[model samples]
Target: MLTPRARPARAAGGAPRGPPPAAAALAPQPAGADSPAAAADGSPARADSPATAADGSTLVRTGAGWIRGESTEEGRQFLGIPYARQPVGDLRWKEPRPPKPWDGVRQAGAFGNRCVQSASWDPGYEKPSHTEDCLSLNVYVPDGHTAQRPVMVWLHGGGLTAGAGEDIVPDTFARRTGTVVVTVNYRLGAMGFLATKGADGLDGEASDGVSGNYGLLDQQAALRWVRANIGRFGGDADRVTIAGESAGGRSVCTLIASPTARGLYRAGIVESGAYGDCAGRERERATGDGAAFVKKAGCPDPRTALACLRAKPAKDILAAQAGFDWGPVVGGAFLPVQPKEAYENAGAARVPVLNGANSDEGSLFAFSRYDGQGKPLTAGQYPQALTDAYGPELGGRVLTAYPLTEHASPTHAYGATVGDRSFACPALRLNTALADRGPVYAYEFADRTSPPFASLRELDTDFDFGATHVNEVQYLFKHFGLATPLNAEQRALSRQMLQYWGSFIRDGVPRADGGPTAPDQRTRPGQVLSLRTASAGGTAISTTVGDEHRCDLWDAVPAG
Candidate 1:
């Protein structure tokens, strides 16, 4: 594999410092909420099963309180449930705390407020009711579930700066495959990743107090909540599996390697995201941005930075961090070391990993340079873009491998090269790293006609995204209302994928009943399960990744 990046920073004591930041311990729901008077508002629930409480809604008695949900034929959805206390005011930038108790039955009918994200260049950065009190999560339990089913908690992806979990609920994913689904919201941008004790003088310490990665810490708190509360929702907390796409996928990969997340999950699924390749050490980025925020907030004094920064309006703070890539950073007690090294040694989490990338994962990324009218790059522009992206030598090799004659245009070839280098190869590297430890099942999602999700510039730009990033997500869950539906063939592929995923979550193996007969090639070469179409050799499982995607030469490319 490509020599791993600079080793990540680690601390001797792995736990958070400064007296655990006040647990804000959540209280159980009041007994009065279950009174007959409250039950009269809605039809009283007949105690047929344990998933629902009185009032006929799919109610769950969580540690914080009783959450009343909207029950439908498809599933019982409890939305906008606060997994942690609101991270506003003094709680801002501190580790997530358990939500405080609520009064009467809390109505979980709609999605919670999305975490604040700065103005972005991608269409996925669409508008939402932005707020700092966005530590809520949603849970959907499928119908006819009497036992503890495997849970799949989803984390949405937007480069760690934007996007919300409500975009794709468990409407179809739950009903079809008998699994509980949970979607979560975490802090983003400056609110999420301000990694320094210098300014806040809180999580940051003179010694090992550099407290950044609050977003990731939020994910951990959410998972811990699931571990404690999902059982009341007919979910097996012990059988929980964490899944995410893109930045969310990176979160899953991070959790796999994080000492903080050990034993919280049984299996992990990463789609279109890997570790170390995307976000990096937060020391420099966070320090630079924190300094800028201090200046912008008019809080130059490090001693008074917290008070002054909080005094500033939310819009000004967001504007200050608009262009910065503020996401998870290495160091701190959260992600202490480089994820690759953490998972590389014998002691890393030995759970099963079902990870893969789409066939054209990088097509939509070319939108920044592609000209109008949906054509490829110009003859001169193609070489310039490649050279600028990969210096000279590697860029030339990438261009030669994907010539204009092979693809529709120069842009198409360039997109392929980007996909191979950024996503596909790194995924292969992860598979290699984890195979020796346990059962490592990798795949290639090659359904070119798959429907797309998220309101993005590429969708409206007349560009053929061609099974690009986030395309596979539509099949796993119903896309947003405005997005199109899947075709017949795509539906079949979705069923196949669901079966594989469900089996893996339930049994820690991708196949329905088998223990994954794929050879253990970590010390040598390995094969991957390719999810191609019926016509393209019918979803063959083999070690042909080198020839199929030209991974051999791409692996040798510098810094690929």
Candidate 2:
């Protein structure tokens, strides 16, 4: 069962802060009507005529109250609705509570504050924008439409630490595909993952005298909110498809196996994430480590832990946060068992699944370059490292599959092999497993050799990061407005990709209209579509690139 609260922040002892300046300024504006005479004059007429609503204004009814959103050209309706009550003060480390109903139309044009996070990787990270009382969601829908449309809920990825729903621009998908898109913000870091011993001494349960896995609970609250209120936005809540990449993909996998999330979404797309058995119930006993760390901080007991944490400044929390490898815990009422166990026992929702991975996932996490102290490992070092990590025999097999000699440098080889095993290979494993339960579509993005980012230009490497992680996003969203225009062939392929994705959301299958048919047409083993640049101009497709690339080899490879 799940518990909901309104304003857990107040219970924690701290008062909620007023809406930030950004949020306060989202009041709706009126649009202006243009006159034929004025248009003939060609003089820039008054921009805000009587016809338009002033900037940043919209209204939508929600489960809790009437929410007003800011307007943008991307869509007709947008609501920055608060799905769960603020988690401030006393509510600091507890599970999410339901948001209290407001008496009147609540202004929701501005984005809510993001959860407290470090400014290490993200330049937009600001202090005022980070807080404990951040449990809001943003909704985008077609303008003036009352009919139900397919809904796509997006989860952002920042390694479960940084990134906001506001960062993603839904204009392309909303305008091009005509789907209602919802992006959400959830708790992160210690605030979300910390597990305390319950009264019953169980992990992630109330018995530990504390709530745990608050982040996961926060997502559930968002989904519940969508189910209860999406209809108001002309969205068919029952047809909702949850999609995400990276850590968001990990969360999708978790939700796939989470009993609480069973009926929340009908289909799921996990890009670059895998369903695997990592740490499980028995492994969570060490969550008491938080208690020990608190004790080391000179706190008396668990009761004082929340207060002590709150009283400590944000910087202190960040500084002390080092050395803690926090993530979702199993054995909780929410999870019940490990994800792998749930998947194997057929405990997961029986829904169509689309799972795939980029060719080079580890390049994004090139820690050696970031640390600056260690030299990039050489090709000779990879085999030993693999052997050390996975044993000599297994390491030999891994080396044979990912032969470092095939690459120009050791770093390139290591990154490719690790990325394949850690992300790509496991994705294949997941698809294989899900295929037995329901219709499954699997893919591998292999676009290689794109223009290098300014940061990587100095590397002077010829290594084929082959479709490095996130490279597919450009084609998927078309947000950047690339300088080099895609030729006719490329445009055709782009349309096909978009149509496939859009159709998949509309129905359960991702099929294109009027195309060459093959044995693996749509549903067959080794059925994969390869999108590549053709010699003539735009792009070409090979029904199955695996025959040439030996993609089936991926199925036998063990996950790192």
Candidate 2: tens digits of C-alpha lDDT, residues 1-560: 00000010110001122434433232222221122112112343242331221122254546565555555555654545788988776677777888876644466655677776666422234232346667888777756544578888888766666656654556566666778788888987667766666665444334234545677788888999889878767788799998877667778878888898888999887777672423232434536656655565555566766567767664555555546655567775677777777777897778877777665666654433321235676666778876875688877876776776676566666665556556765765576666656777766655554433222333445444556665555555522222224556555655656666677788877665533221122256555544444433323234444433334554454444
User: Could you give the C-alpha RMSD of every candidate to the true structure, in order shown?
Assistant: 8.2, 8.9
User: In order, how many clashes per candidate?
Assistant: 3, 32
Q: Worst ten-residue run, lDDT, model 2? A: 1-10
Q: Residue-wise lDDT of candidate 1 within 1-560, one digit each (tens)?
A: 11000111111011111211112222343444333223424555333332342223466667776667766656678777889999887777778889987655676766677788654433333343347867888888777746688889998787777766665656567767788889999987778877655543434543313366888889999999999988888788899999998888988988887788888998889888863453356566667666776676676877667677666666767777755657666665567666777767764578888888888887766644564346558766887788888889877877787777787667777788878888887888888877767777787778776654554433456566687877787767754322346666666677777777787777877763222332334533557776755555556566777576787876675434
RMSD of 2: 8.9
In candidate 1, residue 454 scores what lDDT?
50
Candidate 1: residue pairs that collide: 197-204, 204-209, 205-209
TM-score of every prediction relative to native: 0.86, 0.79
